[model samples]
Target: MAAHRARRWSLGGFVLLVSTAVVAAFAFLTTGPSADRADAATTALTWSDEFNGPAGSAPDPGKWTLESGGSGNGNHELQYYRDSRDNAALDGDGNLVITARKNTDTGLRCWYGPCQYTSARLNTARTFTQAYGHFEARVKVPRGQGMWPAFWMLGDDLGTAGWPSSGEIDIMENVGYEPGVVHGTVHGPGYSGGGGIGASYTLPGGAAFADGFHVFAVDWSPEKITWSVDGATYQTRTPADLGGKKWVYDHPFFLILNLAVGGDWPGSPNAGTAFPQTMTIDYVRVSASGGSSGNGGATRTGAVKGIGGMCVDVAGASTADRTPIQLHDCTGVDAQKWTLGGDGTVRALGKCLDVRGASTTDGTPVQLYTCNGTKAQQWAYTSARDLTNIGADKCLDTKGGSSADGTPLQIRTCTGAAHQKWTLA
Candidate 1:
């Protein structure tokens, strides 16, 4: 009856969706001339569904609609989706839950149930649609074989030209089999469904995307489609490479959130895959132009020492002045300014050291003394590619010990020092 019944979430605000895990991952996937990047157009507030308000309801009718049936257009998938309380619901925990449980929808249920799988498919098919805008969400995935969860967009004129011609933008897609990996794909003419060409990546340390919730986003603009996880970018796509496929990017399109099962891509549920799987959506948000500036102005790479949370005044110096170490905000100030000579040299206050003088001691104030060329400043980034000063062991560090207004700059030691530890790109 009502629209957008919501719930409680950990993402802090009603806009930002939250996931239940911690991965501290950063890296973008696409941007620049990609279909996703064509988001700099159309209605300002357009449409959005965080599925966050109350419970037992469809999304805001002002924004989205529901798509049902087997052989969904093409993907050759199985589930019989619907716009009902049983399929989609606004769980009290601040989530728009589109559960893919193992239930039966009687004859209406496709594939037959206790249809091996039962879930909902939510989309903004007709009605409100925009040409381009930043599409992002915070979500936690369900773990199970044959499970297909996706956050994507499609052309508003689907009834006319149909898929590939109508262009489909898959901002994020992941199978239950590959938990830590994500796929960013585009479908049109030569690149739709089975022939769709896209790339995938496995985040560092074998990160688990299903570990709770992670922010999955796509910066859609005219130039490119940049895919990012937890604010970190990873891949990109462009139009030229689209082999004659219909470019629906120029027209208005809406977003869709669904948990598909046993499709042409994910195949069938395997042993590891579980039942009653749910793709918890913390929020599905749409913002007018000005998509998030990569990591909100976090420099691509800079002097390490003294870098702290969101360029905050660290050590009595102004934020814009000295080389406050660039660190993961809210974690601690110990990971700011670090060296880049290939030796992990984190610098601070004219010194290059990280974390308690690298003495493995606690609370040891990082000093800007000198570069002893010790292991303290010799940090090695795994799977990270960048040019560092492998010779002098000098680091890109902060000079002053002030978190106040503008402070001076320079490089120093390798202590587990609070002022050292820098972000190298």
Candidate 2:
């Protein structure tokens, strides 16, 4: 898929540049942290649009803003986006249909002079913005040589931060040529345009996505963002994957849905490409962490006991940064008292449980670091009893899986081993 581009218009019609291109493919992974924790964690509905309005009605004005223009959207796209029902409307069947049609009689001018196509773009920029949660949509994508449909998001601070600095997250994007595959990507300062980090999810048996509706979603947290198709995870991007580039996704972002007829990425529609292609959206929903008030929902203060009932200890009761965390006899001491904060940090002695150097390599020692708001300090306690480092996607384990006192703790691939299990008590 081509890099997804973003466009923001001002009174003077000036457009800010925001583009995305997938530079690397992430390895496919299993379900995210919350996927298996239904009995332990819950998600509360934050916002939703079922598209259940009367036939031919516009989208709920209170929820979506129709973006109409023809400035090429910074990607040299050919469609003249319009606010008319001819381009977007409800089918009276609980679906929002966004249609792209060949129309030269509208007298609308595009970046390439006379506009040859018309389409619709909708966004929630003025209505809703969320920081960390689950965002999802069910949709049936359009098909043809130049069809490019997407469900994505942009940082809420776009007006001030501008383009790449504001950040972008593409939950789903599909080009006509790749019928069986869809992509998810993230764009930031050094990774914008063709340098975005992303990955693809292909349907089994080469089934075309246009044939039916598929669910696209992302579970976002302070340190990680996981993408899924039909409830199956395809990729997870963390600060560790950004090569030291700034991780600017720590704030709120809004949503966008659009179908373009042609663009610099997908090229123009071919002679065989028929007109009036439609992308059908069944619903769009957002949910917040259910059990608590902050990011990960659960906040508890106590000792995090691990293998053989040993507590996770801050070495030598130190409050200094870089203090090694170890598995030691449970003493209920301050150094062994860990607070799993709602903001995703596991804190003790005024510091956080951190993966030293933010390293993703196996055996990287876990330590007590002064909280820096980086992924290294972000941790998620799962229902499986694993303390997962969001950046490394690994679990806290006793070195050598030993239960001996003073055994150092480190991050290792999550294996559900006895040594990786912990009890917040």
Candidate 3:
């Protein structure tokens, strides 16, 4: 990800930190309607890093390879990348904090100039690499001049093909100058650096990204990649979208995270720039898209009619986190459409029908949440025609057992009542 002193700009659904410990950190996602259109739980949890260790601890050495150097990355960045705990460590608050601090030692120098700052760069080069999948990170970025933080990937064959020929996929790149805008770009032999093909997504309502943690993700398939922020897809790029350029993203690629200062894209830091700037990463996860393979179970879709003929609906056709999944008049709309996946998940609006907070207590209202392949989202069809969430062994019941239209739904003990009986057809 290269940058020039450019003008300030302005730019996934796969358990958006819904765990009880971190739900509030992601409350901003439930503010508006979402447009998640995932067909099923196609992506399987292939790898992840929850950073659930004590404060000042190092990251999982088995999964991450710390990179240290002041090579400037060929961009004249001022940070001398360090592999120590001072630069990267767990915050004991369920986060991995990567700090960039002022380095006063004038003796430390880079190939281009003196290193005035020190930061961290981490990669999964030796441990994890996949050809295609949904890659994501929940990150709260820091703001100030010359701060360039990125979550990106490079072809696994980097040692052989080198630089542009090896290919690069920048899932998320943010420059402090443009706090509200993030970028997604692909670099290849013919189009690298400034000429790379990609686009920028600006947060709505002039919201600065440094305000909170937001999910940055990319759904990578064989022929295309779709970028989304907080489950809303903003841009998509495919081989056809390349405009005749080479599409070098056909093979495996590994992940990388780094914080750099004083790059070509974002100029040097000014007086207002703060030292000890930190980027907090909630988690990094990858899910492999369950392609056209007829494996998990035949993907089935239809209306799930329950008591009083009310159909289960995702509120307002929204797929956002915490959106209510209630019983409503059957309109046969997309929001009312439901799918039963082989993975034992009942999906709607590209999200799974989840018991709120995985609560097993009676009357716990159900909601639409990102499909995290958790038992809380899994539903099994019983011989009694009742849909039981495997996680809690509770039936999908109509609230109050009422037959009235627009009645809400919740999880209750499987009493085999008429209200719990559902027909998927």
Candidate 4:
């Protein structure tokens, strides 16, 4: 057999430079204080598959397709890939389980030798591929010697350009020998196989990854790619980290999930290894950086312009707890940036606009508090320009109906007063 090359990929050779017009257009649409802040504080759910079907059901064909064969996959793997439900099926508990089982049947064939195991590899290459955005998956990986499970992406031009040139983003890759560690890597020309640019993150407290489901995600853009496990970011790769090599992850890529029995990196499973190892996947989601289409009930974040054209600001631009939230000059500062969340909360400085102590009486001061999902933090920025606090049943008011720059904000009965009227910029 030929040397089984470790599967890897690269970004394309062509460079598509960003134009000034395109940057200006993106800046105008996205909600950010400055034009260079392309990664604004908004995301539109573009695609997702929850795999929430009944027990023994196959994955939705509309969203995924199985890649079957015993071609060794350039890794001299031991498993014979198959498109059968026996290898991949949904467990009643809202998960897609891809199982690698010991194949004991006689006369079974594989590229290297007798087919000793069977497994499944699934991809969304045809159904969905995206360029820049956030891609995430929740998975509980199986454990044992030689157990290799991965959640990764490949450049859309794989058919023509092929590996090492099509660009590959390995969001999550686990080799059972290192049960507590997982890797995130990128492959491209001159950086394929053992030469890929990447990093690894170990679970805290020396915990095995099989202990529970964990989220693996990546924030991909033209400038960089950030990998995180759960909510903690571990590594970020940028053009400067490429060691003067060409950066190739500027185009669209498709998602792939697979569990392999034995591969070059993990070696072959031994007698101590367990049979029927399974990897459970909860869901895969992709989000894009763009303006809301108003179709998914997505929230809008921007400056809340009020009377006298001043902005609803966080006092002293502070993130400190119990910071006074008042009206100030509209300067497009972070303190003035507010997101009218779908959950009915006006959030800024990573906290919610809250009525002090959830008070119901008039003239109670408004403050920025840690978001607790309480009713006091809930608000409705209506078309009539009133920011009403639901728990207090009062409108956000400027104290004494003052339009001064340093006036404090409070909650009062909804009386349609000029102080209660506000506009979102």
On TM-score, the candidate that comes out on top is 2
Question: Model 4, 74-133: lDDT tens per residue?
Answer: 677788767889999999888999999999765667777789899988876644566677
Number of the top-ranking candidate, with lDDT as the measure:
2
Ranking by TM-score: 2, 4, 3, 1
Error of 1 at 71 (Å): 3.2
Q: Which regions of candidate 1 fall more than 4 Å away from where they truly are?
A: 1-46, 109-114, 243-247, 290-425
Question: Weakest 10 consecutive residues, lDDT, candidate 4?
Answer: 17-26
lDDT per residue as tens, model 1, 313-405: 234322222223322333333224322221234333223433333443322333332334455444433222211223334333344544443
> Which pairs of residues clash in candidate 3, taking residues 3 or more apart in a chain or in different chains?
3-264, 3-265, 4-264, 4-265, 10-202, 11-181, 11-201, 11-202, 12-231, 42-290
TM-score of every prediction relative to native: 0.55, 0.63, 0.61, 0.62
Tens digits of per-residue lDDT, candidate 2, 294-334, equal: 23353355688988988899889976668899988998876
Q: After superposition, how far is residue 21 of candidate 1 from its true place, in Å?
A: 36
What clash count goes with each model? 124, 1, 10, 4
Better of 3 and 4 by TM-score: 4
lDDT order of candidates, top first? 2, 4, 3, 1
